[model samples]
Target: MELFEGRPADCSGRQEREVRVYDLLDRLGIAYQRTDHVPAGTMEDCDRIDAVLEVTICKNLFLCNRQKTAFYLLMMPGNKAFRTKDLAAQLGVARLSFGTPEDMLRLLDVTPGSVSVMGLMNDRDNQVQLVIDRDVLKGERIGCHPCLNTSSLRFATSDLLEKVLPAMGHSPILVNL
Candidate 1:
């Protein structure tokens, strides 16, 4: 395993989820860079990881409507402010709140800071709708934790939106933020 410092350190015994993500990328022929880091579960932690990875790690928020019948996993630029009202209006759902850790684990198979677009791979039933901010779509490359917060990965934005999602049978809703 390579540390975020760009040095090839041994990630040999850890990172099962990240390994699966890399395998998925390899199978899809999507190029990416992986950076292993200390486990982080907050925005501050992500900032530290970003310094090493040299690209912004997107903020992934797992949300559910009041009824919990509708779930959304939203990805956006880390610096952007999230306005719940705007999102609710655009999505035509009632107010959305951060999902509980248990819900995240059960629905996306992810813990708190590890929430990511790759988690959609486990969303076989398509229960959680994926939403991406417009700014995130314009980036040349996007960074995300591979299904865990201890490591981050980068890939071309086009590959992620066009190839990987389609392969995973997920069609993301693009929302202008």
Candidate 2:
């Protein structure tokens, strides 16, 4: 994969959701680097994308409580081990489990392999809460899919916290794990 300064010049075959992410970042005046690749299905695939983007791609999980009423989008270090019990304890929730693909699409407008903080833009109802690991915030830049697994983007962490998230109308709850 090769890194480009911004969105592709020709978006003829790009997914609309991915293009929307680029549009939002441009509108927010947030500078970013982008790389297009095949859908990442494993850690090794992500590693290659990370190498090209020069940032550790976050492991974004779409989860929910047992009742499925409360949904969450979690951004954590790709290398970190995630224990549902640990996060459940921190959030004071009963049982946390991976949400259904249907719910992910309905809430974030993203599918299972494409969960991303950028997807928060589609959550107009504010139904899904953002949960980010503190470790991810320590970095100067963050890497994530642009609501699609076939492409990845990296931007200033500050842009995400101060600009992107705010523009998306979602506030993140920071956790250690």
**TM-scores of the models, in the given order?**
0.89, 0.98
TM value for model 1: 0.89
Task: Supply candidate 1's per-residue lDDT for 156.
Answer: 84
Q: Each prediction's Cα lDDT score?
A: 0.83, 0.94
- lDDT per residue as tens, model 2, 60-144: 9999999998999999999999999999999999999999999999888999899999999999999999999999999999999
**lDDT of the structure predicted as candidate 2:** 0.94
Highest-scoring model, lDDT: 2
Task: Work out candidate 1's RMSD over C-alphas.
Answer: 2.6
What tens-digit string does per-residue lDDT give for candidate 1 at 1-177? 344332125557765666677778879988777776778866787887777666788889999999888889999999999999999989998789999999898887889878999998888899999999988988788888889887788778899988999988899888977
lDDT score at residue 159, model 1, on the 0-100 scale: 94
